[model samples]
Target: MRSVLVTGASGGIGAAVAHRFAAAGDRVAVHFVSNRAGAESTLRALPAEGHALVSGDLGDPEGARQIVDAAAAELGTIDVLVCNAGVAPSEENRHVIGDVSYEEWTSTFRRMVDVNLLGSANLAWAVASRLIERGAPGAIVNIGSRGAFRGEPEHPAYAASKAGLHALGQSLAVALAPHGITVTSVAPGFVATPRQEPKLDGPAGDALRAQSPFGRVGTAEEVAAAVFWLASPEAAWCSGSILDANGASHLRS
Candidate 1:
């Protein structure tokens, strides 16, 4: 069985992705930051063996290294790396470009960019380098968002960071392809996770759902399914593709 390391595996899409891989009988390393309890909860949801909990704040380069190191040591080797941890600032903190405060905008952008883009890049670099050195092919799946393609109002920073992630995936795919490593991205739109429940309950949510061809919000599992497939050996030839799981919302544009 291949060993996979899933970052942000404590909740939402990350948790679902971890469970999906574990259920498929892969050795899983569920990585969390300040969510030991949540990580353990995800672990409990998985099968009895071939799974482990790893913790680190990946916002720091050193912490990202530590996470990959621990996962590789525990799982023998990192065959799949899922960079799924991300953050979206609250509406209160979000502001249009000209209206946003310098402090709030800079800090919020830093948090999102550092974790979503830099953290993923760090882990990708570490895992890809190891795979190259060991002469083994591997896969890296980055969890991006449909917002990366369509601009996000009042959340330019978050959108930009995710866009950067998409670009990073493509770059890694090309650079590592010769080494037999594949990198792909999954972009989900309006997924129905606990973090999105509040927004989905109101009229705004209803309007957003109506825009989708499916007429409803997508599920974390649905998004995870795409990630699972992208990381699978079957998708080895599908590297650098950004699979859109947005229920055709982007089609309307």
Candidate 2:
């Protein structure tokens, strides 16, 4: 069975991706930042027996390297990697132009870019190195966001970060293809995850659902399924693709 490393697996789409891989009979490395309990919960949910839990602050370059190394040491080299950890936009990090202080804007952008873009890039580098050294084929799937194609008026940093992530995947796809490693990304729209339950239950629920023609937002499982397929050997030809899982919320040319 393949050894899979899914970052941010403490919850949400990350946890879902771990579950999907486990269901396929793969050993999973559930990586989290500070949510040990959540990571344990993810580990317990895995149907397979060889799953592991790893934690690190991917925003730090050193920590990012350690996370991948720890997973590989525990699981005997990761065959698949899902870069899903990110600093999502929320009430705390929301900073609109003309409504926020200078310090707030700069700090917000820094955190978003560090965690969402650079962190993923670092993880990819570490995993790709191991795959190359082993002369083995592998896959790296990035968890991007629909906001990259559309826009985030209230959280420009989040949008810019995701946009950079998508571009990063495209570039790496070309660089890694020659090494028999595939790289792809999934840009999901609004998804129904635990962290988003409040928004779905609040008055804005209808508005959010209305964003999609399906009369609902997407789900973590849907994104996970796409990630699983993209990471599969059969999908190697689909590398560099940025599959949109936005439930028709926004369409781009």
Candidate 3:
């Protein structure tokens, strides 16, 4: 079984991804930032054995190193790295270009980019470096967003950060190929996680859902499934690809 490290293991998507690997008999390192309780709950929900928890703030560059190091130290080597931890600014602070304040824009962009972009890059580097040094083949799956390709009027920062992550995945795919490391991205549209339900309720939510050709939002488990496939040996030839889990919502007319 492969050894996998999933960042943001405290949340819906991250936890689901961890469970998927664990259920498949792969050793899983569950990484959490502030949700220790939630991470523990996820561990309890999983099948017994072969899974452990590691906590760190991905917003800090060093945090990514610490997480990967700890997990590697325990699991010997990481076969898969899932950079799934991320954050969006508060609704109250959501901004458009013209209306965005300096502080709000900088802080919002920094928070998202730090964790979503930098953190992912840090983990990718750490995992890829180790894999290269040990001459092992591995995979890195980055959780991107459909918003990366589409326009998000009030969430420019979030969208931009995800866009950057997508680009990073492609670049890493090429850069790490010689090392036998593959990097790919999974971009999910409106997923119905607990953190998203608040915005996905009511008329506004219904309207947004209607925009999708499938006329529905996605589930965290569905995205997790995609991650599983990307990390699996079956996808060895799928490096640098951005798999869309958005139900054709952003398809061109």
Note each model's CA RMSD in angstroms. Answer: 1.5, 0.6, 1.5
- Model 2 residue 3 CA deviation in Å: 0.5
Residue 1, candidate 1: Cα error in Å is 0.7
Q: RMSD in angstroms, candidate 2?
A: 0.6
lDDT winner between 2 and 3, please give it: 2
- Per-residue lDDT over 57-114 for candidate 3, one digit per residue giving the tens place of the 0 to 100 score: 8889998899999999878789999999988645775977778778878888888889
Please identify model 2 stretches exceeding 4 Å from their true place: none
Best by TM-score: 2
The lDDT values for all models are: 0.90, 0.96, 0.88
Please identify model 3 stretches exceeding 4 Å from their true place: none
| lDDT (10s digit) by residue, model 1, range 1-253 | 8999999988899999998998888989999998898899999999859688899887899999999999998999999999998776577768686887788788888988999899999999999989999999999999998889888887888889999999999999999999999999998888888878888897689897987977998999999899999998899999999998999888424
Q: Is candidate 2 or candidate 3 better by TM-score?
A: 2
